[model samples]
Target: MPHAIKLYVRYVDAINRRIGRVVMYMIFAMMGILLYSSITKTFFLPSLWTLETAQFFMVGYFILGGAYSLQLGAHVRMDLLYGSWRDSTKAWVDLFTVLFLIFYLCILLYGGYSSTEYAIQYGERSYSSWRPYMAPIKIIMCIGIFLMLLQAIAEFFKDIAKLRGSEL
Candidate 1:
């Protein structure tokens, strides 16, 4: 592998790993928020913000951890034919399939960016009583999508390396 490709893979992996580690704690945050909400509802007036806040945390948790999930090969895959392939054959097939992933991620990222821009420009808010500003979550969505796109590209590179009898 070339130096630049290796460096790119290393940097992207490191970044996604760090971000994923941080995002993992969001589950606890969501749990805490729900616990508080349950307590409040049982003893006092229900809080409008707790449910929505917990949902937002969940969205962040899923989105932000995507790249790390991809890096770890945690995502599910169809394995009927894949299980029989040799490593290089797998890499070849992966290189071909990852193009579709890259294309899909690109489209998703573009849509996410446009949505985020509209949210920011219009100061969009949710319909709920709490009516939290939508831009923050939209921005996070775009960021997560962008990171996933980068990770997909990194995987493409890794596949190429594998085909070349090396690993990134």
Candidate 2:
């Protein structure tokens, strides 16, 4: 609960909040695209871009929304043991659990870089006829993971604050 840590947490929180809010709006766009694609395929010419574009946007929806979901405590957890714990104990449990998230993110970021790099260098595309560049989706995934890592770090600090009887 030093000023610096609080500021860092706020910064990360703000980034996640802004990205999450913006990305959530894309769901409407996705819906419209899907509807348009359905109508087109059924009645008129089949649009090659619609389904693939929808997939990209759907990935954006889930990946970009991760930190927001964490903020809202929307991620599913088996809470039978967690629910009974006291605040400090709960904080301890959370601290431990977030380590796993951190590890996963680190691995994803490291391993994902090669695919992203390949996409960027070669302009990688899907095997589908549309052949949309794959980098954007992969890049978005990395960005989402980075955001989630930031949010997880903030949450870890919050847990520490709870353990120490300090407000963060």
Name the 10 consecutive residues with the lowest summed lDDT in model 1: 159-168
Candidate 1 lDDT for residue 69:
99
Top-scoring candidate (lDDT): 1
Question: What TM-score number comes out for model 2?
Answer: 0.95
Per-residue lDDT over 1-168 for candidate 1, one digit per residue giving the tens place of the 0 to 100 score: 889999999999999999999999999999999999999999999999999999999999999999999999899888999889899998999899889999999999889999999999999999999999999999999999999999999999999989888889
lDDT of 2 at 136: 88
Cα displacement (angstroms), candidate 2, residue 123, comes to 1.5
lDDT agreement with native, every candidate: 0.96, 0.90
- Model 2: clashing residue pairs? none
Could you give candidate 2's per-residue lDDT for residues 35-138 as a string of tens digits? 99999989999999999899899999999999988977889988988888788888899999999998988898887888899999998989999888899899
Q: Cα RMSD for candidate 1? A: 0.9
